[model samples]
Target: MVKKVTALKPKDESISAYVRDLIEKEHRARANREAAVVYQEFLDKNPEECAAMEVWESAPLSDEIEPRKP
Candidate 1:
């Protein structure tokens, strides 16, 4: 008895577009990992500063900035 094999079809998206999207995703992931490591190190060295930053971020921002007269 002989067995029949089926071939898989390609997606509708273009190969270049798919590859570009994949590269962008990989780049973003790498950037995020690097940022996380840097942030972790910053937190380790300046725990107080990190807490202060969180507080500042949570505080409401002023909508108007005062202009200085020259």
Candidate 2:
């Protein structure tokens, strides 16, 4: 899916533009993670829910989907 860039220019720019950049990136990453989890949940779930994870992983590589493991 193509995501069009939405500019968020807060008047006065309370924080610097650099900080805004960080916030935007982190937000996107967090949202992606939440989405991935919807796919990862396996046990204790209904049949269809468990299958969702498989569907996503089966797709071709496009971008980083997994969270950084320490």
Candidate 3:
């Protein structure tokens, strides 16, 4: 595991930095999954509202829509 971490870390990055980055990414992904499960449960409990949301979600954006600047 140490060898893999050393191999993957950037040339100038510390091992701890690389490991911290990996931990943060996994934490965010797990959070997203948990939020999705909660959202699905809410939708399952509200069929009418879910159907309305689905209709809106399926609609295409206009061609004139522009990306927001940072």
Deviation in Å, model 3, residue 15 alpha carbon:
0.8
What TM-score goes with each of the models?
0.56, 0.39, 0.78
User: Which has the higher TM-score value, candidate number 2 or candidate number 3?
Assistant: 3
Q: List the residue pairs that clash in candidate 1.
A: none
Which ranges of candidate 1 are over 4 A from the true structure? 1-10, 53-70
Q: Pick the candidate with the highest TM-score.
A: 3
Q: Which digits, one per residue and each the tens of the lDDT, describe model 3 over residues 1-70?
A: 9999999899899999989999999999999999999999999999998999999998888757778999
The CA lDDT of each predicted structure is 0.75, 0.66, 0.94
In model 1, which range of ten residues has the least summed lDDT? 1-10
TM-score-best of 1 and 3: 3
**Candidates sorted on TM-score, descending:** 3, 1, 2
After the best TM-score superposition of candidate 1, give how far the Cα of residue 22 lies from its true spot, in angstroms. 0.3
What C-alpha RMSD separates each model from the true structure? 7.1, 14.8, 5.0
Tens digits of lDDT, candidate 1, 24-69: 9999999999999999899889989889989989977866777998
